[model samples]
Each structure stands twice: as C-alpha cells, then as structure tokens.
Target: MAWDPAVYSAFAQPRLRPALDLMARIEPADAARVVDLGCGTGNVTRLLKERWAAADVVGVDSSPEMLATARGDGGGVRYLQADAAAWAENGGAVDILFSNAALHWLGDHRTLFPRLLGRVRPGGVLAVQMPHNHYAASHAVMAEAAAAGPWSEVLSPLAARFPVGEPSFYYDLLAGGSSHLDIWETEYLHVLEGDNPVVAWTRGTALRPLMDAVDGAWATGFLAEYARRIQAAYPPRPDGRTLFPFRRLFMVARKG
Candidate 1:
C-alpha cells in the first residue's frame, strides 16, 4: 500500500500546527546545516528554510511517494530518499535535526536516539515531535474492533503492539547525555471540521499500516467497524464538529 501524500497533506497541515509552533522556537542563526527527518512533502522543511535563509536544508524520508511530492526548487533545500535512522548512523552531521509527526513510526528509539544525537554537531539542536496517541480511543478502537469476528485471527497477534511511548521513556533516553534536553508532552484539542473528521484524520496516518496488513475486503470491513467504534469513543459535538484531543510528545536536545 502506497502512501497518499496528497491525502496526508490535506489533514497534516491543520493537525500539525503544534509541531510548527515548536519548530518556530529555534533561533536560525544558531543553525548552519539543517535536516528535516521524515519530512513528508517538505511542509516543515520549507519553514526551516524560511527561518534560516542561508543554511543548507535537506529533507530526508524513506517513502519515494512522499519525496516525490516534496518541492525541490527551494534553492538551498534538497530532498533525499533515505532512512532517517540509517542516515544518522552514517554520521550525517548537521547543526539542527528537525522532525515532526514522524518518530512514532520508528518505535524503537533506544538506539535511534543516541545515533541521532551523535550526528548533531556541538552546540546543535535536535527538535522532534511525535503523536503519543497509541492508547487513545481512536487507536484502542482498532485493536478492540479487530479482535472480533474474522479479523481476530490476523489482528490478535499484533493487538499488543502500539506505535507510541510515554514521556518518561524519552526522558530516560536523554538522561546523562551532555546535551541540554527539554522533553514534554501535550494534548491538543483540535476542533476538527467535517462529518467524520476523526476517521479522516486517522485514515491518513495511523490507519495506513493496518490497511496494508489486511486484504481488500477485510480492509473495508476493518475500517467500517473501526469507524463505528471511534464514533462512540469520540462522539460528534452539537455543532457538527468533533473535539479531537490529540496527545503528542516533544523533545529538544542541544549537543554541548
């Protein structure tokens, strides 16, 4: 199953407002070489370039489909198809490593964290934001709905898995590191528009992997059941809207 960058961009911009806000806090003068890891379509990457006009900006992602959608004529900005973890491991040095709404997909951060930290030059910063909604109803519903009927046999084994971690988990990883680290979590109550905004939001991000794991017929059934569960879990407001309380984790570490 291929990633629909268009579908993703439609929802990502609005939902990812917090991420952009966090990225804005960085001082451009402090960064010379900047990299946006998991840069889906280069939305945030563009912001980085605008902030640091003289810096060399690179957008790295593993998806060819996503890279294809990224704009390449930004002069100093270059989009590369590369695994973020692998790139960091190979000592792809930079002054700032910026990431948004992407790290959660690469669940095991124990090794990835140190490797990325090593890639940052002295006094450089690593700013990252990831959704911490694995335990939320939208995701919980998927596991619950999948465990019933015919889907159980296939989904049960994977039910115990979810793609997010607690705030303390990251604090522990950055502990004892020489860099100055600031890690925190927040819940954003997004006022989503449309009749089924919750479904629309998940369809673009969280539900992609599950959709790929099942057959076409089963995928349809899975989404239908998942939608019903989500409707109950996150009911619509009186004004034909839903308040999506999305939780996210962020960490900003500066290498000394």
Candidate 2:
C-alpha cells in the first residue's frame, strides 16, 4: 500500500518538532545548498528553505510516494526519489546535510555517518536526528508478544532487525573525526491527544514494515496487542493526554 500523506501528516507533524528545533541551531549564513536526507513528504525541507531563503534546498527519499506528496510551489525545494545512503556514498556534496527522524531506518550508523560526513564540504555541517526507542516497552513488547503467538515462526525473524541504538554510540562514531562534532540526546514530552495516539504514531513511521509483512487479520491482532502493551507502559494522564517521552539522538558535525 502506498503511503497516505494525509494519514501520516496528522501524526508525523507533531513528532517532527524536535527536528525543526535542531534546524534552528544551524547558521543561516552558512546554508547555501541544503539537502534533506530521508525527507519524508518534504516537510523538513520546506522548513529549511524558510529558515534560509537564499539557499537552494533539496529533499531526497527512497519512497516515491512520499516524494510525490512533497511537491510544492512554496520553498522552491526540489524533491528527488533516491537512496540517501547511496547518495551520500556517491559524494553528493552539500553545504548542509540535514536529516530529521529518518536515519534510524537506514541502519548501521557507524558506516552511514562516515559516508554522510564525507558528503559535507569542508567546513560544512551534517546534522541528524533519530528516535531511540527500540528498547522501550512500546517496541520491546511487540516482539515479545508476537514471538509468543502463532505468528512467531515468521515474526520472530523480522523482530531481530529493529533499528535502534544508544545516543553514545553515535557520539563515539563522530568523535576524533577530522571535523568538529556535537552530539546529544533529548526526550520530548509530547502531549498527544487521541484514544490511540501510540497507534497513530506508529502508523506514520515504525509500523510500515510490519504492515507490509502481514495480512489484515494478523496486522490488526498485532496492533491491538501492541497498543495494550504501550498503554500499560505509558498511561494517559487525567487530562486525556499521554506524556509520550520520545528520546532522540542529535548530531551536528562540521568538517574541518
């Protein structure tokens, strides 16, 4: 199934607040050619253009459907459907390589970081942000519950590929590099409203692969169990909002 921009936008938009905040830290004067890797629906790319109006901004993603929805007249931002990892490897140099909440999908940051760092021009910046919630009960319980079910034969193998790691892991990769690097982690307490906010959040990002892997019955069952586990782990407050503490890793590195 193609990615429905409408459904995704409603949930993903709020989660992207931290990424936009990180973008604000970049020097506008230093932004001439900006590239947004894994630019889902081009939302962040548009913001980058707004922040640096003089810059030529481009958005790149592996999903054509997401890239198609990214089309807009506003930012003069060009959207391209391409593999970010390959683009970085081919030396698609830019003044700033910005990625928001998308790096975790590519996996193997140790290698991906070096490739991305190489694409940045000397003195240019490479900024990235990704969610670090694989170990959280929301994700962990999904695998545990699935492995105990009849679908365990198939789901168990897929669960092993969950892409999540510690912030310190990325910090170590950028450390001692030829460039200056700043790496940190932040937990955003997003007060989301809705009876199934956790489900809404996963549908936009983390649940895609799972949805693609199973039929409707299995998927529905999986989501139901996952939601129950998530709600128990992250109870909703009296005000009808959940304190969804999303932990994210950020790195801003400038090549020397």
- Which residue runs does candidate 1 get wrong by more than 4 Å? 72-75
* Cα lDDT tens digits for candidate 1, 1-256: 4789877977775656866877866655467799999988887788888888888899999998888778644645898888777787874689988899877778578888877878888888888888888888887887887886587788655655766667677777775563578888888888888867788888898778777779877878888888888888888899888998888888888877
Residue 143 of model 1 has an lDDT of: 84
Question: Candidate 2, which segments miss by more than 4 Å at Cα?
Answer: none
TM-score quality measure for candidate 1: 0.93
Error of 1 at 76 (Å): 3.7
| Model 2, span 1-256: residue lDDT tens | 4566777888665667888778876765567789999888887888888887888898988887787888854468988888877887884679898998878878687898878888888888889888877766657766775676666776767666657567677767766564677778887777889885876787776666666678777877777777787778778899888877677778898777
Total clashing pairs for each candidate: 0, 0
Instruction: Give TM-scores for every candidate, taking all chains together and pairing residue i with residue i.
Output: 0.93, 0.91
Q: List the residue pairs that clash in candidate 2.
A: none
**What Cα-based lDDT does every candidate model obtain?**
0.80, 0.77
